[model samples]
Target: MRGGVELTDCPAQVSADFGGDTVADTADTRTPAQIEADIERRRAVLAETLDEIGVRVHPKTIMGDAKARVVSNVDHTLGRAYVRVNGVVSEVKGQFVDAEGSPRLERVVPVAVLLVGVVGLLAVGSRRRGGSARRRR
Candidate 1:
């Protein structure tokens, strides 16, 4: 046996039992050159298959595919977030706008009052801290 393959003197019996025809061992009458050529052909085919598989499972190929998937997911997430934010902004704007597209004073006045109150509280806190720092200095 060569390379775990049985080198038979009567391959016709093997083919008959296997119910298949051999390429180089047709009628069990292959020359040595035919056998060598068949072996070389099979080796070439195997090398090509290995090369293809290597490219498919390569680190760079795998990383590139992963990066593409991540970028696509990020883009989809950002698109959905932008749509949701825009929808919320439009709803808020609608609440503050009248049928004539004029600003509603009632809503605007309350929001402005709240904002001013927050700012005044922050200013008062900062002034008190500044006064204490001045006393230390």
Candidate 2:
């Protein structure tokens, strides 16, 4: 193709066979009015393409698309987190429950005692610190 014109075998051979008549001479069969009409049609198509590109690259359109994508991602992340948390809660609940879904007092009492021991240690540590500070002052 040269200057947007495709040189098919018929047209190329015609130019070579007709020696003096160049491709341009044969291709210039369209009248001035027809050429102008073609130009106008091409310009309209180009203008529409440019307008579409402009809309796609516009700041508001870009920002809106980005915001929508972020929202979708955040929603997906939160949904996954919620499912994981629910699964963990169910697993923990199962651990604290028996085969019949009754609370396992044996496991519960031990965990309760461990939590109380941790709290008691924290209270004792804080009291010791406070007492040492008073003595230092």
Candidate 3:
């Protein structure tokens, strides 16, 4: 069986190098204020693992029914939109177009704007009926 290819054991330990504590015993070994407090505790554990994967498992996963549209360059402040089926969340501002056509945000809307509020309520109902008409005496 030499060179015939046959290897199969069974264990589940693990640690070799990838476990850390080597690299010449981490060179300087903690200092500079404990390495900036371990880089602020690893950036607060990577901001709580990106808030548990972008605001709690990104709405739950995504891809509710795919093929949905309407996306602008939203910055923040409750432009909320998140959901991802198959992967979990389900639906919330989901999108498509991947191969680099551009737009791509796939869910994450906590309170999106909603069509700039129906165009500011039809611009205050055409500026309140465009004039005035009230003189009860």
Could you say which candidate leads in TM-score? 2
In Å, residue 129's CA in model 3 sits off its true spot by 51
Give each model a TM-score: 0.66, 0.67, 0.23
**Residue 21 displacement in candidate 2 (angstroms):** 14
Misplaced by over 4 Å in model 3 are 1-16, 19-23, 29-32, 39-41, 60-137
Candidate 1 lDDT over residue span 1-137, tens digit each:
22234445443422222334443333555677876787798799999999999998999999999999999999999999999999999999999999899999999999999999999999999999999999998
Tell me model 3's lDDT, rounded to 2 decimals: 0.46
Q: How big is the positional error of residue 117 in model 2, measured in Å on the Cα after superposition?
A: 0.8
Write down the RMSD of all candidates, one decimal each. 6.6, 5.8, 23.2
For residues 1-137, what per-residue lDDT tens digits would candidate 2 score against the true structure? 33344435331222233344454436456667866887798799999999999999999999999999999999999999999999999999999998899999989999999999999999999999999999998
Model 3: per-residue lDDT, tens digit, 10-117?
122212343445422223444578657766886999999987777534533443323232223342322443322433332222353345655454432322455677
Return whichever of 1 and 2 wins on TM-score: 2
